[model samples]
Target chain A: EPEVTQTPSHQVTQMGQEVILRCVPISNHLYFYWYRQILGQKVEFLVSFYNNEISEKSEIFDDQFSVERPDGSNFTLKIRSTKLEDSAMYFCASSEEVGRNQPQHFGDGTRLSIL
Target chain B: GESVGLHLPTLSVQEGDNSIINCAYSNSASDYFIWYKQESGKGPQFIIDIRSNMDKRQGQRVTVLLNKTVKHLSLQIAATQPGDSAVYFCAENRLTGNQFYFGTGTSLTVIP
Candidate 1:
């Protein structure tokens, strides 16, 4: 089964520095999403991307966050300034299309650690 | 904003036994629901899903029961195995949007 893939299984960055997380969604998927999970907390939605644009975003996805589909296969999330609270496991998910019953498949996730 | 939540934080059961996980959703407008499993350090994996029009749906070793009257959902696992140990979450989708709201989750431990 084809699955979503993310680069840099783990990322460590200094506070105030910029960080970019990369994801390669399934080749045929049309909708992509990003979600984060704090150490022992519930997974939270960050943003959803479709047609090279953002469809929806949560409050956590503030001014510091931006998502870009620079190319056909790569989707990237850039954080302008990192903070301690930003440390968490970031997961990339993709669905064939946005519909009532379509399921979203997730990647293993990239653990981001801020120092 | 409504939320989906689990009733139990942790559950331990012996291998080969049946396990049941319950969830409560407060969104009356939600028409779709899904259950996912996540292992440590990994992302949520899709398990099974149910639509509000149906009262129950069954998969390989899992069954999802929906009680729309009480806004309750339950997942039943038959012949649970050690590999089934993980955190399970219930998520609901609103009829007007594509976003899914996830519940806190329930950790299941299968005793060997």
Candidate 2:
């Protein structure tokens, strides 16, 4: 089956450094999302993207974070300056269409570790 | 903000037995619910989903029951196997344009 794919299974960066996490959603998917899970915590929604723009974002998606569909198949999340608290497993998900009932398929996730 | 939470933190069952995981959502407006399974070191994998309009939906070896009136959901896994050991999470979506709120998750251990 087609699946969402993320790059760099693991990443380690300095607290003040920048990091870019990339994802390639299923080819036919129309809606994309970024979510994070701190160790032993719930999965938190960061942002949702549709039509090449941000459709919605949560409070956790602050100024330090940005998402882009830089190419036809690539969706990326950029953290300007990583913080220790930013360490978490970042997941990229996508759905074929927008509907409350539609299920979103997720990637394996990129484990971000900030020192 | 609305939150989705699991009633139990963990559950242990023997192989070939059945497992039931429960979840509660504070948002009455939540119109969609999904159950996901996550193995160690992996991401959440979609298992099954139920819409608010329906009370139940079933997949291969899993069944999902939703009680919108009580704002509760449950996932039932039949003939559980050792491979079924993982963390299961229930997520609720209040709107089509909104993001889903995930539950604390229940760790399921299927013993052999």
Q: Which candidate leads in DockQ?
A: 2
Q: How well is candidate 1 docked (DockQ)?
A: 0.63
Model 2 in CAPRI terms: which quality? medium
lDDT of 2 by residue, B15-76 (tens): 99988888988689889888999999898999998888899999999999898888889898
Tally clashing residue pairs in candidate 1. Answer: 0
By lDDT, the best candidate is: 2
Model 2 lDDT tens row, A35-110: 9999999999999999989999999999999999989999999999999999999999999987556798999999
TM-score for every candidate vs. truth?
0.95, 0.95
Docking class of 1: medium
Q: Report clash pairs, candidate 2.
A: none
* Tens digits of lDDT, candidate 1, A1-115: 8989998899999999999999999999999999998988888889988888999899999999999999999999999999999999999999997665678889999999999
